[model samples]
Target chain A: MQPNGQLSRFGAMKVALHRLAFVVLVAAAFGLMLLGKADTVLVTRLSHAVTDALAPVLEVMSKPAASVGAVMNNIRELAAIREENARLREENQRLLRWQTLARQLQVENQRLRDLANLVPDPRPRSITGRVVADTGGVFARSLLVTVGARDGARKGQVVVAAEGLVGRLTEVGARSSRVLLLTDINSKIPVVMEESRARAILVGDNSNRPELAFLKAKAGVSPGDRIVTSGVTGAFPPGLPVGVVASVDEGHIRVELFIEEGRLELVRILDYGPDGIIADPGPGAAARAGTD
Target chain B: MRPTLWQTLDQTARRLIPFGLSLLLLLLAIVPMTTPGFLRAGPMITLLCVYYWAVHRPDMMGYLGGFSLGLLEDILMNTPLGVSSLILMLTQMVVLTQYRFFVGRPFLITWWALALVALGAILLKALAIALLSGYVVAPGPLIASYVLTLLLYPILAWVFARTQILLTKEP
Candidate 1:
């Protein structure tokens, strides 16, 4: 629409402006990174505000994803129904038998507790929340739940699915919270071998299976050993089922967590009370909660 | 020098299309898909949008739009604030600088260029994340994401092209 010479001049100006914009943007981003590093509270507040604003929209967007997941699950479930039915029938019979024994043990346990006058720990309370977003990718593992500080969700609370420990509540927003899954590289939980009572740390490495670390020398942990929360760290209550040791190689002991992070829909956040190991997080604790 | 109301509204709508599309991409990236392997390392859908808009409508989606979208992603994904912002801003710069070569290329050529750009951008993102987190991120999943993003680009590009047509054809 213009003369060639004029068009070329206009093109040069546009390109120059774009280059200048690029430089300004890069510099601004660099400055933000430095700001993020120097002031975690500011970064956390910024993240929280942004996440809070987007939570409702993200929740709406995730509905189709959840339905697709449900449909896929139904298809998979349909494939082996006959064999699964038989297996479940047999397992139900076995569970019925164990139910009788468990009742007897409960009666005896109550009597022993009465005799010993042991002050029972308060039963942990829980609040349920829906998964609104999944931030996991190749590098980090985390999910944003629909519950937040207004719902009494706090940092360091244990998040669980029906199967077992999902992770811990790391960041609590005004209307949303971030759950750091146990498979995240930053996740570390204290666990004990159910059979052997040997203590170790469950460390995530951004894989489906987390590894057992800092096991005592000659602790005799083997594949298939059931692991549970030791309650020693006070972060998690004792006896919560964690996972089974999947393998015991020369140096690595991997655990397949009972929770399937992919199928997570509703998660329960457990409040272990004042005496619980996770200290009551104060104002600045939000920024420091993920550090350790 | 003031424009009529309809012209102003038309210009506003045109300007918003790229930003709105890119924001939609950012939202899509975080959608919780339970499908194994797909959601774990889902294609970088937002990155594809940045490249598409940079190629087709650089006037509308500038470095600021790229930075804002990238920052939104970083906040949503809970990564260091500027990691994605920096990568996306640079992606815009790269695509715009090479715009002349790509302007009239065949589809395959553009596709290949996009794949290469995506690969480099994702690799740069990985390096930045590792450096920021002070941990060596495993490259296995990153490579998987890169490949998946490359494979899905054509489909996404087609979608973006349709949206562009819609934007340009609006009265």
Candidate 2:
């Protein structure tokens, strides 16, 4: 081959390589997007792995920053003490009423607990974790908590806050796990409308309010209706408060989550598995079983 | 006169500046992911950085480089995969076409133009996501983010320029 022809051929090869690289990168980006939508498992794993690897460095860096932020917040609060005082006064009255209701509910809850214990499987092991980071970027909604497989934080474990359902643990590492926020576009929870018991799919759209999909038009759902996990998918337990209906538009309803994303500082990871509920004994089964 | 070895080294370093800056910008773009409500505003910081580099260093920050950085941002930020890449490539094209006008402009004017570009990039990204996903697109959050990015532009631009100057100084 002539020298010029060989040089030109090499140039063509270089261009081909560049084009191939571009194709691969674009394909990778598309795969990631699809992955982001299809399931939370991969994201959860990536998040836990990344954060676990980076946590020590982040801890060292964020400590001083957090302390500085706290100091600034304190200063701001001091400046607005009068306004805060008034708000607190109003809140205290509300708390008093809640306290009264809480006591009554606690007693009733104890009675129900006793009844449930008599049935079986009264105790379920649970672990508590603090939300160390809510670092899932705009397209991905996830929270990194300080509990992982080492702490019995298994995949698909339901995470709840003091208020209500937070999300399910999608991935777990040795000492950390990723909680796919209910608002992630990839998140879909089988939920039932509290008032009409209408079954619908709660789909996240990377927004504060998740859209209710596949809801029956005649479901008679209205604004302010509560939503809870139906446990139909055998992932989350039934009857956990998920969110409340914020707005109902044509063919889509939005939920105002009970657990605020910004304020999720701590959560309890339930140890319950797919077989959450134990079957109750049939009528006369107790006596028959005793004889056996 | 023929370029000296020192001149060649300086030129190489000058070209390398944008690449390093883009990485840092990509990291900053992902910072909002750590905080709630940060990502909804669009990839503002990223748009700004890409615009700046495309204007200042088009030779280095070409189509493929811009696209790759956008893709990396998407992976790190966990957004729709091609969303940032599409926006970035478009922004790079726009900035590259108008590179000459921005090269010698005053810092404030440069910042203002960047703010405008950031706003446009974000709006386009939001519209694309909405159309693709068939999701209920709220204009409110996008608007809020645009305003915030505009307000943040001068500070970020200043920091970026300072870093470039500090790093590329002739020893």
Candidate 3:
């Protein structure tokens, strides 16, 4: 690859040096990959540090696209307003009926709780954060939200969309945090089929539909069954709305997450301070959560 | 004759423009388009930038700069830390080695070269991520991004071509 006969020894030496630099850089990159695997702590800190340092700049840079997206969404919403209003009106009527029944059941449930002397579920506080960046790639599905450790967000806190549980915080920074979306391969959420009570792990395979694995054989799970966090592991709160079973393939149970691909502009990160639903997050997430 | 200090500074800044533009593209890639189903359809602007400059101005776009930008993308996108670094540097290496052939070629030929290089790049990235994570990644979404990258080369190439002409013009 010497230049077409304008090739001097000096030019040859420069190309050699350039290739050498590339080789050295590629080696260094592979070395960093090794370091990332062997020392997740260092890698995690580096991710947090860089993301935290650049959060404001990232926020500002993302605004133009955000505005454009907002405009597009506004137009679409405007177009659908008539149908949406009618649907909401019908939904309001149905909800009004449920409201009276819910009030009656509330009294009965409270009376039963008093009779049994049961401890009540503590209400966890929540903090709202804007979706600053969708950090997903071909391999990992993730997001960077504006809320972070400064805002009481932590490693194990859960993120909920308007529809359902979307993801969990895997890394918390000073002004931003990374949400490992339920579709990421590294994510293994302990969820259960709400109707059948069958326990399984919702496994992300880098696909739109995260599949359910480890379901008990012959478990009566079919399409339309609801899936929720099982509370089997305390990493996530139990009973957070997750998604519905989209299909039940041979062994794969594909779930359609409520947080659609493009509409996650804002998310809610529940505070997992003392007396939160995460009673014991085992040795992994809780310890990291406590440290930061 | 030797250039004056201001002229030297202006020339230096011009040399940095390609890298600056490439960085801007990388920053914008992580921002969502906000329309559903359009996220995966966005092209790899960084890859195209690297290829465009490597073909036209290899001296300006160095391996170290490309590697740094790749690392930045990894941090911003929350991918495995070094994966993008490897993919981008390797892609630049391909263009650097073969850019002479691509220069002054038909637009179709240049686009064809980008198509081949982009294909190799995505497959390499997918393979690396699969090996690292031990999960079988679906190829559909990855290929979708690649197709968009293919579709983008012509439009972005015209912009880069204009910038190159500007660089060569008299001040």
Encode model 2's per-residue lDDT on B1-171: one tens digit a residue.
Answer: 799999889887877777667766544333322433554444466666677666655565666766767765654454555678778877776775676888878877877787778778887887767755656445666676677667766766677678667765776
Best by DockQ: 1
Error of 2 at A33 (Å): 6.4
Cα lDDT tens digits, model 3, A118-181, are: 5544467899988777756666778888998888998888889889998889889989998899
Residues A1-292, candidate 2: write the lDDT tens digits. 6999999999999767755755665566566557666766775566456567644443444445456656776998999999999999999999999999999999998898676544333245689986655544344677667787878888888889988998888767888777888988779989988777788889987678889998875358778899998866656666789999898777578899998776566689988643453334566447434432
Q: What share of the true interface contacts does candidate 1 keep?
A: 0.66
What are the DockQ scores of the candidates, in order?
0.62, 0.22, 0.61
Q: Which stretches in model 2 have alpha-carbon errors above 4 Å?
A: A1-61, A79-140, A146-151, A171-177, A192-201, A212-226, A247-253, A273-292, B1-40, B58-68, B82-90, B106-151
Pick by DockQ: 2 or 3, better one: 3
Off by over 4 Å in 3: A1-10, A217-219, A274-292, B33-36, B41-43
Fnat, one value per model: 0.66, 0.13, 0.63
- Quality of candidate 3 docking, DockQ: 0.61
Displacement of the residue A31 alpha carbon in candidate 2, Å: 7.5
> What is the descending TM-score order?
1, 3, 2
Q: What are the per-model numbers of colliding residue pairs? A: 1, 0, 0
Q: What is the C-alpha lDDT profile of model 1 across B1-171, one tens digit per residue? A: 699999999998898888898798778767776446576775677788888888877788888888998899888776777988888888888887788988978889988898788888988988887888887767787788889888878888888889888888948
